[model samples]
Target: MSLPTPLTAEAEDSAGRRTDVLVTVLAFTGIAVALVQTLIIPIIPHLPEYLHASASDAAWALTATLLCGAVATPVMGRLGDMYGKRRMLLVGVAMLVVGSVICALSESLAPMIVGRALQGLAHGVIPLGVSILRDEVPAARLPVSTAVMLGSLGVGGALGLPGSAMIADAFDWHILFWTSAALGALALLLVMLFVPESKARPGGRVDIPGAVGMGISLICLLFVVSKGADWGWSSGTTLGVLAVALIVLPFWGWFELRTPQPMVDLRASAHPQILFTHLAGVAFGFSLFALNLVLPQVLQLPKITGYGLGESLATAGLAMAPQGMVMMAVAPLSARVTKTRGPKTTLMIGAVTVGVGYLLIMVLMSATWTLILASCVVAMGVGFGYAALPTLVMSSVPASQTAAANSLNTLMRSIGTTTSSALAGVLLAHMTIDFHGVELPSENGLRAVLALGVGAAALALAVASFIPRHRPDAAVTPADAIAEKVGLRPAADAD
Candidate 1:
C-alpha cells in the first residue's frame, strides 16, 4: 500500500521549519490545557477556607470546568475542522487566559466557577491538534507525535498535581491560576507564530443543530453525573436531568444521522471497531480517573482509620508522580505493540493489566508500598490502553473524520470518568465506617471507590477481548470500502 505523499507542496511551503518543532509546540499546547484541569485539585482543600466558601460549593470549581468541557469539546472540534485549527487554538488559548485571569482574581466561588467554564474551551486543543498532525506532518513522524500528544493527557495531569502543590505551598492558590494563565498566553503566542492554518474542508458546514443537540445532551448527562451525589441521586432534580438525557440522547443520535454535516459522524462511529473503541475508552477513562480521584483521598486519610496513610497533599501528589513516569516509559512500547500485534492485542493486554492492578489493590491494601505498586501497574496498563485506543479509532475511521471521531472518543472517555466520579461518591457515602470513638471513612471514603474501579477495569478487560485483532498490514476489507465511501482513508494511509 502506498502512503500519502509526504506533506503536500502547499503544506510544505507553510511548514518551513522541522515539522517536529511544530508538532512539539502543538503537543505542548495540549499538555497545557490538561494541566489546567488537574492543577486545581491540589488546591481544592485550601480554596474553601481561602474563599470563605463551603466545601461543597468550592468543589463546583472542578465540576463546572468538567461539565463545560464535556459540552464544548465536540462543538469546538467540529468548528476547528470547519474553520481552522490555528484560529481555534488561539481562541481556546484566549479562553484559557481569560478564565485563568478570572479565576485568579475571584474572591468568591461564583466568578471562579465561570472562569473555569471558560477554561473548559481549552480542552478542544488536543483533538484539534491530533487532526492537525495528519494535515501537516509527514506520515513517518506522525505516529510518534500522535503518541506524545495523546500521552500528555496522563502526564499533564500527573505532573500538574505535584507542580500545583509546590506552587500552592510556596504561594497562595491564586498563583496557580496566574501561572497557568501565563503559560496559556505563551502557548497562544507560539501557536500564532508557528502553527499554520489547516487545509480547510471544501464546502464543509457547521452542524449547528447537531452541535446544539449534542451539547444539550452532554450538558444534561454530565450535570446529572457530576451533581448526582451532592443533589441526591434519586432526588427529583437528579432523576429529571437523567430522564432528559435518556430522551435527548436518542434524538441527538437520530438528528446526527439525518444531518448533512453532523457534529460527529454517527454512521462512521457505528462501525464495530469504532464502537468498541469508544466503549473501551469509556471504561478505561473511568478506571483511570478513579485512581486520580481516590488515591489522594486514600493517602491523606487520618491514620486513625485502619487503612489510612495520613500523607499531606504534596506528599500524596509525590506518591502518585511515579505513575506518570511509568506511563511515559510504557507509551512507546504500546505503540510498538500496536505496530507488531495490532491495536486489539495491545488493548487487550492493557485492559487485563489494569484489571490485575485493581485486583492487586483490592487484595493487598494493607500497606503504602502495595498502593504504590498497584498504581504503577495500573499506570502501565493505562499507558498501553490509551496508546492503542486512538490508534484503533484513527485506523478504523476515515482521515476526514479524525477530529470529530477522536473528539467523540474523548467525549466517551469524559462520560466514563464523570459517571465513575458520581458512582464512587455514592459508594463512599454509603460505605462510611465508625472506628473506635471516631468516624473513619467519614471524611474521605476510598475503599469502596477503589473496589468500583477494579470492577470497571474488569468489565473493560472483558470488552477488550471482543475487539478483533486484525493485522496492521492486512489487506483492506469491506469496512475499508465503506469508510472510503464516507470520506475516510484506510488505516495504512490514515496519517
Candidate 2:
C-alpha cells in the first residue's frame, strides 16, 4: 500500500472540515432567525409615534410577526419535506433579508407591518435548520450539534434583547433591522457555501385543503389569543372569533387525517411519544415567554413600585443577557444528559429546573443578582427542553418526514407562547399599582405571573413524564435506516 501524499492528506482534511462548516453555518442560521424575533423589542413601545399609527396599529408590528410565523412554520416545514430542506431554508432566509431591508427603510405603519409580516415567514428557519442538521451531520456529533443548533433560539433571542437595546439606544431605530438584515445575509451566504441538500425528499403534491384548514384554524385561534386583549377579550367580536376556532379545528383535524401527503401526518403524530412531546411544548412555551414578558417589565419599571428594578433598557438588557449565555453554555451538557439518560429524562429535568427557577424568583424578587440567577436557571431549563424536543420528534417520525414533524412541534410551542402572551397581559394589566395616577403591574401581579410560570413548567414536567422511555427495540419510521445508511441519521439519534 502506498502512503498518501501531503496534498492528498490536505484534501482528506478538507472533507472533514466541511462537516464543521455545515454545523456552524446551520447553527448560526438558527440564531439569526431567532434574532429577528427580538429585533424590534426595544423599539416596540415607540412604534406608534415613529410610524404615526395608533398604539393598536403599531402593536401589529409584533402581532404580524407572530401570526405569520405560526402559519408559515408548518407550511414551510412541509414544503421542505416535499421539495428540499435547504432550498426552503434559503428561501426563508431570503425573506428575512428582504423583510429587514424593508423595515430598515420604512417610516410608516403599512410598510413596517408588511416588512414584519415578511420577517415572520422566516421563523421556520430554526426547525428547518434542525431538519437539515439531522440530514447531514454524523450521529456521533449530532447530540452536541443538535443542542447548539437548537440552543440558538434562546441564545439569539437573549442576545438580541441587549444587542438591539444598545443599538436602538445609540443609533437610529432603523439600525436594528439593518443589523438583522446584515446578519441574515451572512447566514444565507454561509448556508449556500456549506450546507448540502438532503436527498430524503418525501416527494408528493402538498395537501392544499389540509393546509388551508390548518391555516384558517390557527389564524382564527391565534388571532383571538393575540388580539383579544386589545380587541376586548369579552367583546362579541372576540367571542365570535373564538367560536370560529372552536368550530374549525375539529374539521381541520379531520381534513388532515384524510388527506394524501397531509401537511401534518395526523395519524403518525397521534403516537403517544409525539403527542406528549408536543403537549409539553405548549406548556414549555407558556413558561418561557411569560418570563420574557414579565421580567423586562419588572426590570424597567420604576423602583417606587417596590418590585420594579428601575433599570434602563440597556441596564435591564444587561441584567437579562446572562439567560442567553446560560442557554448556550448548557446545550452541550444537556445533550450529554440526553445521551446518557434519554431525552424524556432530560426534558423532565428541564421542566423541574424551570419550575424551580420561577418559584425561586417569585420569593426572591428583591435584587438584580437574584433575578440574574433565576433567569439563568430558566435559561438552562430552556436549553435542556429545546434540545430534547428534536430528539423526541426525530425518534417518533421517519427521516423523510423530519421537517414536517419538527415543524408541527415548533407550532405547538408558538401556540403556548401566544397563549402565555394573552394570559400574562390580562394578569398584569388587571393587577396594577397606582403610581402617579398611572397603573403599573403590582408586585403581587409579578409574583402571580411567576406562579403561573411555575404551573406551566410543572405541567410540562407532568406531560414529559408520560413520554414512554426509549427502549432498545423501539420503532422508528421506515426511513430511519435509509437515512443512517446515507450518512445522516435523523435527529442526532439518541445514544
Number of the top candidate by TM-score? 2
lDDT of 1 by residue, 1-495 (tens): 434344544444444355767877887787789899888887777779877899998888988889888877787777776777667778888999999999999998899999999999888788788777666665434455566777777777888888999998899889999999998998898888878777654438778888777877888888888888778878999999989989989998988888888888878777888888899999988988778877777788778775778888888888888887787678677767776778788888888888788778766666677788998898889888877777777677655666667777888888898888778777776768876666545433575677777788878778878776676755333333533544433345555
Q: What would you estimate as the lDDT of candidate 2?
A: 0.86
- Superposition TM-score, candidate 1 onto the true structure: 0.88
lDDT of 1 at 485: 49
Ten contiguous residues minimizing lDDT sum, candidate 1: 475-484
> Would you list the clashing residue pairs of candidate 2?
none
> Which regions of candidate 1 are displaced past 4 Å?
1-17, 435-438, 442-445, 474-495
**What is the C-alpha local distance difference test score of candidate 1?**
0.78
The residue pairs found clashing in candidate 1 are 398-488
RMSD of 2: 3.7
